[model samples]
Target: MVPTMVLVADGTRDTRRKEALHDLAEAVADRREAPVQAAFGSPTELRAAVESIEGPLVVVPAFLAGSDAASTELLAGLDLDSRFDACATAPLGAVPSIVAQLVTRLHAEGWRPGDGVVLAADGGPELPGNSERRQVIDVARMLSRRVQTPVQVGYLHAWAPSVSDAVARLRRNGHDRVAVATWQLVDGADLHRLREIGATAVTAPFGPSPVVIDTLLAQHRAATARLAA
Candidate 1:
């Protein structure tokens, strides 16, 4: 079957963000053993590609949270039409493999067992759904368990306990060294904010990692399996 992978992201005017997304798409396609075309854009743009492509398609929302309004809206918009054979899996943040990738990233950054870590994301009043924030907290908890360190949740925007605040809280709690694990897909204002937060170390976003690519392919396979069933 001719299968296409549609990576849905929030529409951004930033050229860097677009380039990063394009790079990620290319990496995923390269790793895919079968003939797979990768398309990156908003829901409408992805839908156009899906309609034009012959055969089945699987949409993997590149969003970190299952509750992301943009991704949810995109999926909803696509669900309205049944003209194309398409299936969308859960967001990347919901995948268990992300926890492993987070741990790997932290260890690569020289994170010690006792170092306090903060999971930072662009969370605030502007984004819809507390679910996204909750997912970030869940990831923090998972990381805490993996590394045996205290991991806290921090926001770059409209949420309480900003990245700096979380770092301060960790310092006040008697942890001298603190690090930040960015919960983002690409470099943006959130990443910049994370860097300025004064953490001892800050891990980059999970951009086109092998684990991420595997998770995305798994999502596609699961959707395709369901379609076959």
Candidate 2:
């Protein structure tokens, strides 16, 4: 019997976000025709899910940023002494497929070639200095290359130059149209705040789209391949 893959996300207080993650996991499972489960909340909750499953298990963090402290803690909590073989995979954002999805969202939001775009994310203060900001910047650069326009990065909190500031800077630079692309996996208050940033257009978060589902399946395949190898 092959191992089941479990997708884990940072549990959110918002019910909508939780429901979204659950729906995404179900979509992945149906598409792959395999056992896939979603576990939300703390590391302990994820660990319990992993333990309940029989056979081998692959735990994939459904985070936009590559493995964070929560993922690290989840892996630590897994019982190494258990008979089932368990491994964790990288976060969903590491996959390049998301770049195409970002471009698609921007285009759908009426972004033109010369339009300035701001990649908005929630930068939590709990993380180390500038880590989340830097990651968003890297993704912004990728978006810039794809769209052939300058893409600036902005944070909702714990960082300089909010999304509004980024849009303002672009407007000041003489870009008539400025748009915002959210670098979030699910909807939350931050996304709502992005819309109020006064940008000409604001794209939706990277939800349970085909690209995301494909990326997770690819990650699962790669992890299973490594185990087989």
Candidate 3:
């Protein structure tokens, strides 16, 4: 049987962002026979999500990156490990399609080839595993290659080179048209900051973009295949 999917996302107070996450869950569910649900916030919520589902279960993290860490901790906390067959898939940022979406969104927002660019992400930690930082760097590299323009990493928080700083650096280097490409799943405060921070253009969050849906399905297929193997 196709495994049940629980999409784990950070809880948001924003009504639109919450709806967008749910809409993503509905879209994924529509394409598959297996049940798909979105779980927002807390290990307790995640545990409850998987405990009730029978047979195989796959929890897909809705984060752009670094969710693998959360998944590990949450899965370890669950006593249901032996009660049902379950596993956590990699975060969405690990996929190439997400980087592709950043480019697509940029172009849609009038970002051209010659414009200097900053890849904006919700900041990751500077300490510990630092997985999110690594993934964001990788994404910046891919986006730079795609656009034929150097892309700088400007974190929303918890790091050096804020979005404004990155934009200023581009300006210093003679790039007046600085575009900020957002690598976020849903609209939120970080995106708002990216827009107001002097970039020539800012892209919107991916919020259920086609490639995002593709990424989820691809991960699910790969996970189920590994289990079968």
Candidate 4:
């Protein structure tokens, strides 16, 4: 039986964010020619989809991993639901192509040397690994190394060095053009706030990008193959 794919994301009431998730699901559905559902922060929807599955079920985390408050918690609840046999894939942030996507977006937006770059993210997992949250910071470093420029970090919700502060610091550092590499899969209040803060430019979120959709599909296919095994 062909496994139905479920894309799980950090749920939000924002219409644009919801639409972004649906759009991504539709794109992957079209390419894989398979049934796919987007359960954005809805345990009821996820359970319903799982309980109704005819075959194997594959859960793909559409948001970045290490977001314990979001993806991790959601997955934990799935373990408790136990409505069906399911195979899951790491969150989209685990995809190695993500770095490439960031670099591509940076260059596409006409970023150049002497311009400041900030990896503006929602927040990091609080449970501990490194107090400073290594996931987003590591990503920032990866972006920095690839672009051959220093990359600053700004957390939208939780931690310090807010995107606003990062932008301000860049201004003080003599960077007239500051670009924020928004580390989100969908557009919502966070993106809106990042935009309002006076960054010279903000790279688009990953949602509608083909690279993201393709990576999601790859993750689903891999999980499906695992279930078959």
Best by TM-score: 3
A best-first ranking of the candidates according to their lDDT comes to 4, 3, 2, 1
* Tens-digit lDDT string for candidate 1 (69-162): 4544555566625744767776766456788887888888888888999888766443334366667777777878888877888776667787
For residues 55-121, write the lDDT of model 3, one tens digit per residue: 8877787767732233334434545457436777757664666777778888888998799999876
Stronger candidate by TM-score (2 vs 4): 4
Model 2 C-alpha lDDT per residue in residues 94-121, reported as the tens digit of each score = 3467987889988999988888988876
Residue pairs clashing in model 4 are: none
| Alpha carbon RMSD to native, model 1 | 2.8
TM-score on alpha carbons, each prediction:
0.85, 0.85, 0.88, 0.87
Clashes of 3: 0
Q: In model 2, where do residues sit more than 4 Å from their true spots?
A: 66-84, 125-134
Tens-digit lDDT track of model 4 for 37-70: 7787667767776676666778887776533246
Model 1 Cα shift for residue 92 (angstroms)? 1.7
The deviation in Å at residue 167 for candidate 3 is 1.1
lDDT of 2: 0.73
